[model samples]
Target: MWSANAIKSRREALSLTLTDLAQRLDVTKSYLSYIESGKRAPTPEQAVLLGK
Candidate 1:
C-alpha cells in the first residue's frame, strides 16, 4: 500500500520537499500533492519511483 503517511515520512526522512520529490520523480508538485492528500493514486511506475 502506497500510503500517504509513508510518502510523507520518506520525504521527510530524506529532507525533501514536495517540490524536491516532484522534481526527482519527474512529476508535477500538484500531482504529488494530490497523491499525498489521498485525492489520487500514483501509477505503478510512479509508485515504483516514489518507493525508491
Candidate 2:
C-alpha cells in the first residue's frame, strides 16, 4: 500500500491538481484530498487506479 505522502508527491510531480487526479481516478476531489492529507485511505480498487 502507498503512503499518503507518496500519493501527494506523485500527483504534484505530475503537475496535477486534486481535481485532475480525482477525475482520472474516478473519485471525488474531497476524497482524493482526504487521501493525500492522511485523513483517509483509498480502497483497493482506488489504490490500483492511483498506481497507474
Candidate 3:
C-alpha cells in the first residue's frame, strides 16, 4: 500500500497541484485530498495509475 506521505511527496516533487493530479487521475480533488490526508485509500486501479 502506498503511504499518504509518499503520494504527497511525489505530487510535490513533480510540482503538481491537487487539481492537476486529480485531472490526470480522473478523480475529484476532494478524493485526492482524502487520499493524501490518510482519510482514504486509492483503489487498486488508482494505485497503478499513481505508480506511473
Best candidate, lDDT-wise?
A: 3
Q: Give the winner by lDDT: 1 or 2.
A: 2
* Sliding window of 10 residues with minimal summed lDDT for model 1: 1-10
- How many backbone overlaps does candidate 3 show? 0
Rank ordering of all candidates by TM-score, starting from the highest: 3, 2, 1
Tens-place lDDT digits, model 1, residues 1-52: 7998789888989999999999988899999999898888888988989878
lDDT of 1: 0.89
- Reference-based TM-score, model 3: 0.96
List ranges where model 1 is wrong by over 4 Å: none
Give all TM-scores, in the order shown. Answer: 0.89, 0.91, 0.96
| Candidate 2: tens digits of C-alpha lDDT, residues 1-52 | 8899999999999999999999988989999999999999899999999888
Task: Candidate 3: list runs displaced more than 4 Å.
Answer: none
Estimate every model's Cα lDDT from 0 to 1. Answer: 0.89, 0.94, 0.96
lDDT winner, 2 or 3: 3
Better TM-score candidate (1, 2) = 2
